[model samples]
Target: MAFLELHNIHKSYFLGKEEFPVLNGIDLDFELGEFVSILGESGGGKSTLMNIIGGLDRNFEGEVRADGQLLDHKKEKQLDDYRRGTIGYIYQSYNLISHLNIVDNVLVSLNMTNLNNREKKDRAIELLKQVGLGDQLKKHPNQLSGGQKQRVAIARALASNPRVIIADEPTGALDSKNTAEVLEILEKIAAEGKLVITVTHSQDVANYGTRIVRLADGKIEDDTRLKPAYKTTVEQPNVKPKVLSAGASYKNAFQHLSYNFWRNSLIMLGTAIGLFAVLLFSGIGNGVNAFIQDQINSMINPNSITVMKNPAGKKMSTAKFEQSMSQFANDPSKLLLTDKEVNHLQNLKHVDKVEPGYQLSTYTLSYNSKNANGSGFQTWTKAYASDTVKTGHAPKANQIVLDKAQAATLTSTKKYKQLLGKKVKLTLPWIDKNNHPVQVTAELTVVGFTNGGQTGAITGTNYSTMRHLLSNAKADTQANFVSVNVNNSKNVKSVAKKITSIKDNGKYTFGAITVGDMLDTVNQYVSIASIVLAAIAGISLVVSALMIIVTMYMSVSERTKEIGILRALGERKKDIRRLFTAESVLIGLFSAALALVLAYAASLGLNHVLYSIVKFNMVQITPGNIIFTVVAAIAISFIAALLPARKASRLNPIDALSAD
Candidate 1:
């Protein structure tokens, strides 16, 4: 039985919607140890017949059998095994991997082979020596001469030790002398009892073969055995291609990972920066939101609510009827709230405490050495009717409490402390002559200071002390402010809304804000920041995506002829795609991991700096950030690699082999 057979094969292509037949029914058979040459003009279907025989093109309707075994179309793995184990292909351009050394280039075909590193290295060296490239094993493809690179290509083809060697214009790129040398090698390969097939236009190459098969218009016009059957005495031991173990390809990938570090490094750099931008922006937004909330909480009194009075600016009295219409009268303050009225509001649901706060702008204080004469320190005083005190116990009737900073400034000199027990002179310079500079001497002790030392200060003495100082004179201290404390801090707003109904009845007109409301405002600001940060992050991702696209495109171009060689060697369509995608995924994963590490380091630096300055502890880096970065990187890489990977998978062996 013949070693290889092609029976009644027909092939066609579609030019748009129209059918374009390239090959008519063709038949051929070859035995082991035969040197066969197929010669024809371009587009005469010689290469197409070779493609069908090599199992690179499956579009043809045909029966291709080898060694008496019927080649089943459904058995794709079997076909792959047949191609890997039984066939060797050499291209015209000597498609050696540019990035790999000669030895590593030869081992490229063994990516699917089961051979270990040492054994594969040995086999690769043996093939290289046989092809006269033993001394060039450490050299890159670019370092080799054209003939030398072709010899390296021959070695790569034979690394898997297939039974048949298929050459498509293998000597096309070499000089006449090198062409003769390559043809001599081919003759020797046939002499080793292996079937050798050469597809070429050169009669010189065909002359070295034992048989010449001429193809014309997709048909074999002549199949002639050479007159003398050109022979070579050189013999090589029969070697079989290695079969890879389960998951060996993936394992080998790790072994070869760092071999292309430059490409991987660039890809990793792009991805790392993209992830860094995303995480840094998002984290900053969160930190800022938390900071804002803390600042608001520290600044405002938790129980305070603002009560604004309606304005009646001008007086208009046209007639007695207008005077009778007291609805528009500027007498809202005439019905001043009594202590009973203030206590009535204290009885409302969710009200844990309440206090009536009075603010007077004209009161002033003076010390022996220093004097702060601005409108009563620009602060407020509340009657401490509730049990809540920010600092020490609520002030007694004759005592006062200054904000922490104010107290500290006032007590800076020894004479200022003397004013605490002595008659401290005070004046309401803006008020009428009835309120004079009263020397109200009293036993005044400094109660605890209000307003936490960190936040801004507005709290001052209580109304009990203020009214007591003015007991000899009558003045209206019932001006309008009510502080309400809710049972639960979160329910402040709900109770404030329920109290809004009292405004229509002229009992009160006030607005309330909860800590949640303040927090919500802060969150809105942070959301805007997050959007800005996200936009910046998107820019980095865009840059990363562009980089990946360019890198993969360059890879496709650089490996164009190599892909053609692989296709000719019987790599499946899926295998080609898997190889490129595997490369992309690895690049993405490496970049993401690097980015996470960088982010963690950045967070540490940022936290340390912030703590040193504001004493505020911030910056949180979580494991989720790492996971998110990795997933985002992989997604971007896959997206960027789609077109190039598909292009690589769809490459036509003939066109790619013809490309530079």
Candidate 2:
């Protein structure tokens, strides 16, 4: 039994089942301390035997025994372990990863070992120094000369401390002087008591090794020993290999991403633009809804439900209730509530008090030869928030609180407060009990002013003052609607429902309206608009994902040789998959971060510009939105990279290494 034994190896290639035999009954033996050269011609099957011993070619008619233990090439994991622990390959091409420096390239093999980061770096540096290229540790492969590149590859193969160093034409590309330097390095490696197997076409190169086996037409013609095996001298520490961890995969992925960042940045920018649009539209919708609620709640009491005589004597939906406002405008007399109807609502459960109010469709206020016509005149009740009156108190007898616009008409906006104590003539067209139209007028004092920051800004007066004026004009004095104040705010909804349940002779008599109902209607519309705009903006994200897919496929094509290097270095298929997926995910995260920055900048700028007009910030991005954006970005990129990553992991190492 030898240190490594090959027994009767037979191999063939087939072109559509036409078998072409390459290796014919090849039997070989080797030891740990000898530098053996397999000297052969182009088609002499030397490379095929090397692939079998290196655990790269599994489909063959052969049994490879390493120190009397049979090498099971059929089991992929065992083959991977064999390659990681026993075999180190130095290719003719030098096969250095273009992106990594000399030290990092060597560390690629050392990464699979159970060494800490500091120990790995020290060992890689030592290996580079041993090859006489320590000063070029930070230089990439393309920047190095042919000799330097082969030295880096040799250093990398030696990093994992494998027992058998296999050099497949290691000095094939170098000149005489550099070739002598490389052969010296290989002899030194054999002197350290490791098996140095070199495959070569040059007779002079074979003569430099300890033994040369001449092969002609896939059969060994002669085996010659030029020198004795070097005695084992230096002992090495046991380097236990481990599977590639996710963190290492991500680090590799990030390095590749950074190297090609200028190309990937366009994808990130497109994705960020889409994500920013979604964030912006959603933020604006939230801001608009909040602004409307603030404006409405500031002027009206949320706990009070406005009670109106249902024209159809049945409960109406909010949409129907809105449509009925025109009906109220058409016949104010028919919509008027009588004393008995008002009392019926006042006595209901949870009813604090029902304040009978008149809502005039249109009214005119004149003062000192200036007039301002407005609409939605009503008698003020507890349903109105006290803060609505900015200048003075609520209306007293023969007094009215004008909308700020109406007061500003009679005087300058700066001097409008001066008119609070001034007398004004209030007039509106009304209907008599006989259904005849009449002009109702009264000279009143302006006690306060209101500015609701929305449309339908109307003048307000007390019930008694409006009744007195209507009576003086011989017009109808009945209240059209009443504000039903609930004792507790929480019960407002239930009480409003109870009011609708009230009936007269099998017909519903009243309909109730709360500030919540109106606000809910407004919020619903805003939410729909937000979703629609965000969905439209999301189209660009699809394009970005497609871009990522195309980019990953292109990466797979470009890094085919790198994939072969990693596979040969004992990285698992799953590791290759995760490497590509991790890169795409990083792209997603970077895009999300960019999107957030853009959204915030745009929102801040717009809010600043429009703050004076709306008196509020119109865009608000929440923390939840930020989190959702990041998660969405990651998911999209990960999913987009799946097929490409799978394709990359499934590539054949032999084919990939042969790719240009």
Candidate 3:
């Protein structure tokens, strides 16, 4: 039994079903320590036979046995493994990857070995130095002469330490001196107990080997032994090969991206612009919502919910309850809450206290014969934040807190503080106990100023003080609204729900409104606006994805020959597909990183400008936004790369190796 055997190999090409046979029935036996040359003219079967031995051409009628193990051509994976572990190929063109340096080109094969990265690199350098291109390891293929290129190819082939080395016209493009050096290298390789096969048409080249087989028109014309085979010597252990892992594919993809970064950066910039827009708008929406909540929370107690009489007699949302406020204005009697409802609210769970108060729509403040019209005048309760009183104490008995504007209306804007200690006549029309309108008047001392929130300028007095004045005027002073203060801010919503659930005869009696409900209504509108703007910005991402798709297709077209070389190097279809997809995803990853930086920078600039007017940051990017940007970039790139990568993966190794 021989080290390798070929039995009756036959191969053909078809011109639209018209058969053109390339190889006839062939039988051969090869062993270690032999430099066998297959010499033939152009259009003969020398290269075709080499392809069969190298496992690149499997659609043939034959069986190949490597050390008596039948090579199964029917199993694609088996053939890939056979080529990866058992065979090394040297081509006349020295098909090195253009983007990779000489050492990197060799490492492409070493990456599949079980050796560690440091070990693989050390061996690659060792192999390059052995081939006498030690100083040229950093050089690309274009920097080298024809012979140097061939030497790099030889180093790459030997990197994986395959058992048999197949050279297809290895020295066809070299001068006589380079050819002699290459042949000597081959002779040394054979002496180390490895089978070396060279396909050549040169008679002199054939004569340098241990044995010569001449082929004329696909049939062996003669078999001649020039000299006895070299003595087989003890060889070092070969590197154990493994299937290409996903990590190596991504690493290679990263190298290629780095090699062409300037071009890829343009695509990344385009993608980053879109991501930045989305990130910025989302941040702005977040900040806007936060600012609104902050401002509202500063003026009103979030732990207190304002309960109003349910004029419509049903459970209502904050918005719906707000819509019914105008009807209460038409008939103020209906707005008054009964004593029973106010007492019920105080008994609810989480309720700290329930303060019942009256809200007067029309009123007049008279001081020093200066009169100003006022509205939204209500009795002070726990619902108003103490901070809302910008200056002075809360209104005491016979005292009223006038908002700055109303105080300014009665006096000069600069001297409104002077009116704080002065007495003012407050008069308003109110409903009697019989639902008939009557006039109410009081002399209340102005004690403080406020910056009213939600409702403009509010004038407030104590509940007992207002009740006393109304009773003196023979007018109804029933509480129109009640503030249900919760024990904890977190329980505000639950208390509001409980209040809204309080019913009479299957009809909700009171409508409740909390600070959170108002903030939510404002936030809902802000979110819709931001989302619409972000969607408009997303148009650019679609364009960016299209650019990536076009660029990947161009890469597949440009790297078609490289794809073929990788396939010939024993890479599987999925690995080849992964190469392109991985590169695209890296592009996306970098683009997202760029977008984060962009969004942050833009936020800083815009916030600086907005802070001057609003006294707060207007854009705030969150962790969720960062994650979304990164994920979006990767998903778009992966989707964009699918078709191009698939096309690259499906090319025939033999046909691809021949591509110009």
Top-TM-score structure, candidate number: 3
For all candidates in order, the CA lDDT equals 0.67, 0.89, 0.90
Candidate 1 or 2, higher TM-score?
2
CA RMSD per model (angstroms):
9.0, 3.3, 2.4
How many angstroms is residue 473 displaced in model 3 relative to the true structure, after the best TM-score fit? 5.2
* Top lDDT hit: 3
lDDT of 3: 0.90
User: What lDDT tens digits, residue by residue, belong to model 2 across residues 210-291?
Assistant: 9999888777889999998888769886677887788889988988888888999999998899889988998999899989
| Error in Å for residue 651 of model 3 | 1.9
Ranking by TM-score: 3, 2, 1
- Cα error, candidate 3, residue 289 (Å): 1.0
- In candidate 3, which residue ranges exceed 4 Å CA deviation? 324-329, 360-375, 405-418, 423-430, 433-443, 452-459, 469-475
Give candidate 1's total backbone clashes: 0
**lDDT, model 2:** 0.89
How would you encode candidate 3's per-residue C-alpha lDDT over 388-410 as one tens digit per residue?
Answer: 88988789799999988888889
Candidate 3, residue 451: how far the Cα is off, in Å: 2.9
